[model samples]
Target: MERQRMSTSEELMHLPWWMVLLEGIAALIIGVLLLTSPGMTTLVLTQVLGFYWLIVGVLALVNLFVDHSLWGWKLCSGILGILAGLVIIRHPLWSTLFIPALVVLVLAVQSLIQGGIKIFEAFRGGGFGAVILGILNILLGVVLLSAPLMAAFVLPLVVGIFALIGGVAAIFGAFRLHNSALRASIQQTPT
Candidate 1:
């Protein structure tokens, strides 16, 4: 029996296109703002980072009590996120300069782990796309980590680039979905 291919919708359900585009657009906007106001960028970045960390931490904390299986990991992540959030709040200036570097470090570590898992999963009959995505993620993380200080200066630009790519991907996916739906409806009509 031939393995069934996943439809565009099915793939996109797990990776929504509009959300990707929105995220990209938001980053692009932020990048533009940062470029126009370099002096204020640090404060803006700090506030954004702090809020983000705080929200994620709160969500993780909630998850810890809501799910028993992931209690340990959730709780740990929650605590760490909260602590990081507080630090950012307390030292916005420092956070603005250092948060990007921290992000790069964390992403680099996470990408390696995620890529390894993807490679292993692919070996065990997962999709080739997963492996490819994993490799790309790892490469991106490595690039971020290689020159974190320099990357920090260009963080907004990097984020904008990522977002733009993601947005384009989302738009393409959306069009694919539109075409598929059109085709399916036409096929279902009486000849």
Candidate 2:
């Protein structure tokens, strides 16, 4: 019997190599720039964050129209994104100073929720990685709360590293998205 072909969405999981390399390079550049001048990074980061929020909000809103099942999540994500973006747009300088603390707070909350979800998934016998990530998040959140000053100082560097890693992963994932045959082979491989 012939193997069933993977769908485009499934293939998207395995992105192309060039895309991954590009993403990695971009992330590395951003990381290096941030590391070299952390003080200046504050203003730049605020602007970037503002734009990111707007983009994400728009994306969420777009998804709401396209996928009704995600209406609740999409609406909340969009509204939050828009609000965050607007705050930055209104007082970018003030926002720059406060963004770090807010970022930590938001991330801490996100980590808690993500960790909880991971723990639940692990209990259901799925995604051990999620559980590990969840634990890491919990630790990170505690560290951020306990040592806010230290966290504020070092958070940018850490964010740079995360961006580099995420970019690389996205690039790699993009390749997977492009390679249907490879995706099938990988999926067929026994875990």
Leading candidate by TM-score: 1
lDDT of 1 by residue, 72-128 (tens): 888998999899998888888887777777777787788878888888888888889
Q: What is the total number of backbone clashes in candidate 2? A: 13
lDDT, candidate 2, 1-191, per-residue tens: 13335555444444555666687778877777777787677778788889899889999999999989969989999999988988897888888768787777787777777778878888888777878987887887777677666677777888877877777677666565557556677899999
For model 1, the local distance difference test gives 0.74
lDDT of predicted model 2: 0.77
lDDT (C-alpha) at residue 128 in model 2: 78
TM agreement with the true structure for every prediction:
0.57, 0.54
Candidate 2 is scored at a TM of 0.54
Which stretches of candidate 1 lie above 4 Å from their native place? 1-9, 13-46, 66-71, 104-148
lDDT of each: 0.74, 0.77
